[model samples]
Target: MAVADLLALINEVILNWIRLHYFYWANWCGLSTCTTRYLVAMAVADLLALINEVILYWIRLHYFYWSFLAIYPVCSVNDVLRYAATDCSVWFTVAFTFDRFVAICCEKLKTKYCTGKTAAVVLATAGVLFCLKNIPRYFTQKPGTIIDNMPWLCAMVASYYTDPGWVAYDWTDTVLTPLLPFAVILLLNALTVRHIIVASRVRKGLRGESKGENRSDPEMESRRRSMVLLFTISGSFILLWMTVVVDFVYYQITGIGNNLNESQWIFTCVGYLLRNLSCCTNTFIYAVTQSKFREQVKSAVKYPLTSVLRRINKSPS
Candidate 1:
């Protein structure tokens, strides 16, 4: 069952604007803590995913008025973009997890590893790597049309059964997309937690309560809160990504096609909702959990509206 078009469109708009605003605020404030480039890259990935979703919904629609639409070239292009965006989005989250890991667990190396330049280099590498990885998608998914319940379907012509590379590729993506990232995130978060506990005990054991040391405690607390925010985001990611991974893993291993049974259809619907919902949620998490982020959002929202009002008030009637 497809999501209603109007609701999907509304989701696209809201996700797009809020993320764009967050990006602008992060940049404009020159916030060392928040302006990490991975966040910006993640925003771009989310928008790309949202746009791909809109295009996918449009392509999936089978209207009686346009029964003879030619999809030979377009479907392959759409698949390439969709695959690329999905890959980039997942890898960006992985990069963020690495960022948080270095920041919290490896304090001695944090200055070297967690800088903005380093983040940019990592994000760029991930983008290029995933784009190259999904290049085969463009070549393999030849476009054609098939009739489904009298509605023509823009379909891929690739066959996983005949092509061993296609089968390998599907399995590789399945591992990279969810399994590896989830494992890495869990491992890194655990390490970070252990480091925090050790550091807290050391601080408690210290004899001198210098003014500088006292001030640094708040900074450590702030960093811990940011780590918590990352934790929530990763948890959301795992929740959203698990079902699709399971569905794909099951299909590839068992060669069982989803024939729109009640269970399978429900699985698909939940996957779709989770995938899109995951893209927009980080911004909300930031807003609710990060006080600094909330302040930036207020300024981002206030200045433009205030300027427009001032312009209106000064204009001659």
Candidate 2:
């Protein structure tokens, strides 16, 4: 929990900076407006998820139990929002993956589907759907205790574990989130790799690279850049979430109950640790994969100091 708090604090600061950069200086950045919109949405979603899920819920419950956020109604509402924020973050990544897949593999559809207007519409629609989907979570929570007739600390309703409807909802929710996104991302990446390989071979032949003529294909180069960003972000997501996926499958298969043994507890904790870690990794991925993004960061960092210096020079010292 301490590790999670530290990481969440660092992530909060960095994501806020990244969000500001992407939001205000978006036009000046080299990425397409469509891609820029997705990245900005991702940063916001990640920030909300870290704040609500980790700091507000986990850290506050453990370290600052007296806070009013632990009270009934508010705690339940926070849980719903936390789930929605997390859903938005996961699905937004999947949406961006699909967008890139269209841009790279479906040349005929890319122009229309990969525009800023389409991106906005798609993101807004997904955001609304996920928010609605998580509303039922509010009812599944009961108070951990009642103090002076006031309920405190949200806990799962007793029936949630045994009720058929709630069980189905839990399964559906899990499947809808990391599980479905996991499978979809992997499938899309596989198809993308196959397409790129075939296209490269055909283009190479057309360019006479097969005839001992060495030439640079600008089209392939462009595709390569797009692929780098897509794969790095998606790949990092998959790697980080692998433990959580495996942990889910194991518990389901074994039919484990709440009384987990020590080993099971450790495994679950590690899975959650990695899951939280995923929320912080995309910014670093962008820094490592995109040179233009690095340049934008540098420019954003300089803007503050430059403005202060310019003002100081204008004043009589």
Candidate 3:
């Protein structure tokens, strides 16, 4: 079910990207110029996430044969998948943040700087950085050990308290994965709100421009609404991630409780659900809050069906 959910999310993202670039040119005015780069980055992230889900599913399904499988498998495949997923997520978050930052801050310079070529370079750089950050994990190895009749496939630096390299990995994942992304998003959202407030105030201060006059500018209003929606989406992301972040910190400081307890399992399940839910929630947010996105969806459905009908009508008897 989790794998299915993740795949569905990937599909949603692909559909949204298609709508933004191919169908809703007027709404996503600058998207076509960078569609190739954006799609490539999204594909990389989606593939990594799918791999992670598959590995996790395998682990869960084969838990009964853990003793046999763990010994036969010299390395923990699931851990490797986890590393890949984290790397992909880092790159995806950075790309999304940078895209938003450029769109908002350099609105006037869009044509010059935010082109497909530039986007491609940026995404490629992010991917390289993500891989470099996580490459150490591949070299780290855990001594084979037996636990509860099951061989534990441990990493040499799994415990950060003892391993300097794992400590660095922990800090990097904590900061780059959630902290930095959330910080940048919060700052951008604050600036957007401030800009809107100042504009509103200026409009009110002017002699001829009344509140009604300011409100009448649909373009300005739409931009403001979009920023608000972006902020809400970012807030939701932060909220969903906070659970996992807290769990990480708790494990780092206090460590997991003794015994393989049911409470621990419940917490783990909840954290996993929250993390995956973040990916799924974005589609709902855009669909519900953004008029442009809703319109894009409408066009995506309508245009394709209309084209198909036309082709059928024009077919030879």
- The local distance difference test score of model 3 is 0.61
lDDT of 3 by residue, 24-64 (tens): 33245333456435544554454455445544444544563
Q: Over all chains combined, what TM-score does candidate 1 have?
A: 0.75
> Which structure among the candidates has the greatest lDDT?
2
TM-score against truth, every candidate: 0.75, 0.85, 0.68
Over 4 Å off, model 3: 1-32, 35-40, 54-78, 107-111, 141-161, 203-207, 212-215, 255-261, 283-293, 296-317
Give a tens-digit lDDT track for model 2, residues 1-317.
76577658867886776667586537555678899888888777877788888887889978988787788898899899899998998999999999999999998999999999999999999999999999999999988999999999888888887889998998999899899998999999999999999999999877668666768888988899889999999998999889988988887888775668999999988987787778888756755567666777788999999999999999997
lDDT of 1 by residue, 1-317 (tens): 13466458757875776567555546653446434466667777877776676445444554332423235455556667777887888889888888888877777988898887888788889899888888777667543545563424345444755577777887798788878998988888888788888887677557455545543577568767867778887888888888887877666676665345788778877877788788778656545566666787788989999999999999999
Q: List, in order, the clash count of every candidate structure.
A: 0, 0, 0
173 Cα displacement, candidate 3 (Å): 2.2
* lDDT for 149 (candidate 1): 34
